[model samples]
Target: MSPVIETNGLVKRYGRFTAVDHVNLSVEKGEVFGLLGPNGSGKTTTILLLLGLTEPTEGEVRVNGLDPLRQPLAVKSRVGYLPDQVGFYDAMTARENLAYTARLAGLRGTDAAGRIITALSRVRLADVADKRVGTFSRGMRQRLGLAEVILKNADIAILDEPTGGLDPQATQELLELIGSLAHEGMTIVLSSHLLSMVQAVCHRVALFNRGRIGLTGRVSDLTSAVLGGAYEVEVEASGADVPAVLGGAEHVTGIAVAGPGLWRVDADADVRPQIARRIVEAGGALKNMSIRRTTLDEVYVRYFQETKNQQEKKDAEAA
Candidate 1:
């Protein structure tokens, strides 16, 4: 099946500055795809281009087989967008805000009214239906924004930084809501810098660095088997001799000193038995030895940093 969202050599520029450079992205139907990046890393720009909020300087983008630039209405009708920030009328009640949004999306009469109620309930905002939005706390406002988008029952939803500022409870609620929506067959694409949340909610994620699609795939796939197993070997003694002695052990690829008397050893495979014998022979006081492996954070950093370095080299050569 064709991807619900696809980009071909997508590029967006502001004068001499390229905001999004040659990004190719595809999100399959009913998949919760994540876009990960820091500020100015093209997350927002990509969203805008995909939604036709801004026309790209070069390349093309498609949503559900239609070019957004050519079929804005068709695309817009099928999409629900929760931007990085949401602004709502201070005086309008939660129910009123959703009702207005539903109308704009082409719903009318009781259908719109019922959807308004159902949407509020979905985000756990049913009890706040009568409360004015201005009086709502930051977290509540975030939920209200969510209510507005999902009320339309759009086929694809783009949630930008949906949990950026919410407290723990609110963040968990929103993440749960996103996960539930995906399970219900809505194609969800979200952008977030929060690593933990992405690992929790997204089945597939693309890491963006320096305006390019640096890495993309299932989180498990990226970190799997690649770790080959690792370990943290902490020696209470602070001496260069420890590393010198531990360095010759089989399956030991690299040793990084995290702090004084703290060292992390990367094993080619599970080699705890060999490591223990080696450390003991070195006369090292092995305070702790645990077989640990790579984490998503570590894998993400490794891939992102490598991509950044390669980009720098290319820029230098072009200059």
Candidate 2:
């Protein structure tokens, strides 16, 4: 099947500064795709281009096989967007706010009323459907925004910073809701800078850096590609020579001192047995040892660190 969204050599520039530079992306249908990056990294710019809110200086974009630039209305009809700061009439009830949205989308009467109730129930706000939106918390507002999307019966949902400023409980609830959406066959495009949050909900992610995509793939794939391993072992041992001894163990790709007696070891496989034996041979008292799959946070940090190092090398050579 063709991608639900595709962009080729997408670029946007203001003056001499490019906001999005030569980005090529493809998002499949029914999957949650994440645009991961810090602020000013061009994630929002790319979204605007996709939505036809802004025209790209150069490149091609197709949203569900239609050109967003030339067919914006058609694209808007099928796409729902929830901005970082979701807006609503504070005095209006939850159902009232969604009813207003439904009218704007040309929905009314029984059709609109049924959708309002169903959307509210899907987002778990059915009981509070009549409560004023002004009394709703930040998390509640976010879910309400999502309800608006569901009410539209949109094929694609683009959420910008959906969980930003949400507390732990709220974030978890929102993430679960997002997962359920994808499970029910809605294509979701999530944009956020929180590495761990993106890892929790996104099936695949594109890491943005300085108007460019540094890497794009499944989190586990990126972890192995960037860190040179998929397994990370945390070793807590006491001895002056422990680091040196562990560094030489087979299958160990890299090791970093995490704390006074804690070292994070990156390896290709589960080398806990080898690591344990090495610590004993070196006479290091092992306090603790644990292993788990490498996380996106580590992959993100290591990928950018490598990019910085390469740029520095080229600058030194130029000098």
Candidate 3:
């Protein structure tokens, strides 16, 4: 099947500045795809282009195989968007807010009312359906925004920073709701700078850097490609030659001293046994040793750092 959303060499510019540069992205049906980057790194611009809210300076975009630029109304009818700062009438009740949205979408009467209730229930906001939005917490407001999307019965949902500023409990609830949406076969395009949350909910992610995608793939794939390993063994040992001894172990790809007597080892496979045995043989006192999968946070940092270094080297060579 064709991708629900696809962009090719997408570019958007404002005066002399390029917001999105030569971006080629594809989001499959029923999968949660994440767009991750720091603020002002082109994520929002890309979303705007995809939503037909802004015209791209160059390149192409298709939503469900239809040109968003040419068939904007069709695309808009099928795609739902929840912006970072969703707004509603302060005095309006939650259900009322969604009712207004329904009317705007051409839904009416019994059908609209039924969808509103279902949407509220899906986002777990049914109990607060009659509460004024002004009285709702930030998390509740976010859920209400999602409810509006659900009411549209959109084929795709684009959520920008959905969990931003939310507390741990709220974030978890929102993430669970997002997961359920994907499970029910809604294509989701999530944009956020929160690496951990993206890692938690996204099936695949594209890492944006300076208006371009730096990397795109699953977290584990990116971890292996950028960090040289998928497993990280953290070792806390007291010995002058700890680094040297651990470095000699087979499959040890990289090692960094996290702090005094603390070292993080990256390896392709589980090497905790090798690490423990090597430390013991080296007469090092092992305070603690643990192994776990590498995280997106680590991959993001290392990938960008490496990209920066490579660019610096190229500039130096040119000069």
Candidate 4:
């Protein structure tokens, strides 16, 4: 099947500066895709291009099999967007806000009312339906924004920083709702700086840096590819010589003293047995040890830094 969303050689520029470089992307139907980056990294620009909010400087975009640039209205009708800064009329009630959107989306009377009620309930905002948006909290407003999307019955949902600024409880609830929506067959494009939330809901992610896509793939696949054959071990040994003891352990690549009696070791594989033996033989009492896979944050940081270093090297060479 063709992609639900596809962009080829996508580029966007402002005056002399390019905000979005050539980015080729394909998001399959029913998949929860994530766009991860810091501020000014062009994630939002890509979304705008896809929604026809802004025209691309070059290349082509297709959403649900139609060109967004050529068929803006059709594309907009099928795509629902919730930006990082979601806005609602302060004087309007939650239901009123969504009702207005429903009418704009072409639903009216009993049909619109039914969808409005269902949408509010889906986001767990039914109790506050009649309450004014001015009285609602940030999380409540965010959920109400989601209800507006549901009322539109959009085939594709685009969310930018959906959980930004929410408390722990609210974040968890919102993330769960996002997951449920994908399960119900909506193609989702989630743009977020929150790594843990992306790790939880996104089946795949593209890392944006300096207007370019530096990494893109399944989260686990990206981790394995970037952190090949690496493992982090935390050992608590009761001796100042802990690092010295594990320095010569099998497959041990690097070791650092995290704190008193705490050491972090990196190796090609499970070197715990060798590490344990080395520490014991060196007369250091081992308190505890644990090993785990490298995290997404670690891989993300390393990728951008490595790319930056490589670019600097090229600039030096050109000079």
Candidate 5:
């Protein structure tokens, strides 16, 4: 099947400023795909382009095999978007707010009513169905937005910062709800600043940096590939020349003392046994040693830092 969403060298610019630059991405059906970046990195702008809310300066976008630029109505009908800042009739009840949207979507009477109820129940907002939206908490508001998306019966859902400021419990609840939606066969495109949430829920992610995709892949694969499948061993030993002992060992790339008696070793593969042996051979009294896999957060930070460094070098050379 074709990708549920596809962009080819997508570019969106505001005159001299390029908000999205040569982005090529494809999101499959029934998967939670994440777009992660700091603010103003063009994550939102990319969504806009996909939705045809803003036309791209160059390249192309397609939703469900139909061009969004040419077939906007069809694309809009199949896709539901919940932006970072969602709004509702403040004085209206949750049910009322949803009803209004359902009506706008051309759903009405019993059909609309049933969908609204189901959507509210799905988000665990059924209890507050009749409560005024103005009285709802931020978390509750977020859930209401999800309910609105469900009520649309959209085949694809694009959520921007869905867990932005929610507390732990609420964040967990929202993520669980999103996962359930994916299981029900909805293609979900989630954009957020929360790395942990993205890691927990998304099947794959594209990391945006300076209006471009710096990295893209499964979180685990990206983490491994970005760090060259590296692992770190944290060793605690008394008299061990741990650094010198493992400095030139097979697969050992580098070593450094972390604290008074703690040393960290970076390796391309599993060298736990060798690390232990070298420490013991050097007559170092080993206290403890633990190997840890690289994390998505670490990979994200390193990629952006490296990209920034490269840009700085080019700037300096030109100067």
Candidate 6:
């Protein structure tokens, strides 16, 4: 099946500066696709290009089989966007904001009213519907922004750091909304710095850095392969040279000194009992051992650190 959103070697430039450089993406229908990147890594630029907010400088782009560049209005009509910093009239009430956006989204008369009420209710903003946006907290405003987007009943939603300033409760609510939308087969593309949140919500994810895609794959497969379900075992000993001993162990992949008299060894698989016996036989006292799954944050840091090192090496070579 053709992808819901596809970009081949997409590039975007502003004057002499390139914002998105030869980035590629593919998102399936109903899938929650994520762009994971730090600030200024071109996540927003890529979104803009995909949503027809900005023209790409190079390569082909398509959104749901339509050329967004040629039919921007068509794309925008079916797409909803919630920017990182949403702009709204501070004096307007939540109801008022949603009502206005709903009308502008092409809903009319009774349809607009129904959409406004449904959206506000979905975000639990009905009680605060009459409250002025200026007085609303950051989390409240984030909820309002979410309401505004769905009011249009868009097919594709593009959210840039959608959970910014939201508390745990609000973030969870937003995540649930995304999952609900996906269950209805709504295509979603979002950029997030929240690794755990994305890992929980997104079916497909891409790691972006320096205007390029560093990695893209199914979140489960990506993480499982990276982790290999390894366990960490720490031992205490005096000058036992744990690394040397573990280096000879067939199942041990890595060993490092974590602290004075503490050694951390990475096992290929969970073999805590075997490792304990080996340590005792080698005269190394087993202080503590714990199994830890490699979290999304750990994977992100590892990959992004590699990206930064490579970029630094390029800069050094240029110099």
Query: lDDT per residue, candidate 1, 96-203, as tens digits?
Result: 888888878899999899888888898888998999888998888877887777888899999899998889998998888888889999999999888767888898
For residue 231, what is the lDDT in candidate 6? 56
Score each candidate by Cα lDDT: 0.82, 0.93, 0.92, 0.88, 0.89, 0.81
Model 1, residue 152: C-alpha shift (Å) = 1.0
**Error at 198, model 1, angstroms:** 1.0
* Candidate scoring better on TM-score of 3 and 4: 3
How would you encode candidate 5's per-residue C-alpha lDDT over 1-319 as one tens digit per residue? 6798999999988989999999999999898999999989999999999999999999999899989889988888889999887888999999999999998788979999999999999888999999999999989999999998899999999998999889999999989999999999999999987787789899999999879999899997887677655587888898967777787899887677799999887777888899888888999888998998777778888788887899999999999
Best by lDDT: 2
Superior by lDDT: candidate 2 or candidate 5: 2
Q: Which parts of model 5 have CA positions greater than 4 angstroms off? A: 247-261, 267-270
lDDT of 4 at 110: 98
Model with the higher lDDT, candidate 3 or 4: 3
Local accuracy of candidate 6 as per-residue lDDT tens digits, 40-141? 989999998988888899987899889899998898888889888787789888888777887677778888887788888888888878888989887777
Q: What is the lDDT of residue 238 in candidate 1?
A: 41
lDDT of candidate 3 over 215-266, digit per residue (tens): 9998888999999999998999886477799766789999998988899899
Name the regions of candidate 3 deviating beyond 4 angstroms: 238-240, 259-261, 282-287
Check candidate 2 and list the clashing pairs.
Answer: none
The better-scoring model by TM-score among 4 and 6 is 6
In lDDT terms, how accurate is model 3? 0.92
Compare the candidates by TM-score and give the number of the best one: 3
Q: Alpha-carbon error at 248 in model 5, in Å?
A: 5.1
Q: What TM-score, to 2 decimals, does candidate 3 have?
A: 0.94
Which segments of model 1 are wrong by more than 4 Å?
Answer: 224-253, 267-274, 281-284, 290-294, 307-319
* lDDT score for residue 299 of model 5: 81
Model 6 steric clash pairs = none
